[model samples]
Target: MKFALVLVVIIGVVSLVSTILVANRVEAEYSKSVKRNLTNLTLMYVLLFLVLSVGIVWYIVGVR
Candidate 1:
């Protein structure tokens, strides 16, 4: 679960960053919506990565 979460978040960040860089040239309602969604998704991904990293470290320490 920890590794999966990390992969998911990294992918999300990369994909969103690419989309944002590409979408900057556009001026449309759809572009605005996509930007908004991408921003929110990226925040969620950072939070997930933080939580999973802490949880995994805690689990590992407890096991030993």
Candidate 2:
């Protein structure tokens, strides 16, 4: 179904982003620069994901 496909795609992307970008930093030293960079990246990615999800849902709903 379209809903299932969309859910899978969104989850897949989120999982990939978390695994690739966020998980690797857990073992890293949290110096000021590294912490700031990580925080910024996390915020950017979260906002991007939210905007993308909203856009996808809007487009899908409007298409019908």
Give residue 35's lDDT in candidate 1 (0 to 100): 80
- Off by more than 4 A, model 2: 1-30
Question: Top model by lDDT, which number?
Answer: 1
lDDT of 1 by residue, 6-52 (tens): 88668877877786687676767688677887788778767877897
lDDT of 2 by residue, 1-64 (tens): 5777679678867865775566457655656666676677777777877787798789889998
Candidate 2: 10-residue stretch with minimal lDDT: 19-28
* Each candidate structure's count of clashing pairs: 0, 0
Question: What C-alpha lDDT values do all the predictions have?
Answer: 0.76, 0.71
RMSD in angstroms, all models?
4.1, 3.9
Q: Which stretches of candidate 1 lie over 4 Å from their true place?
A: 1-28
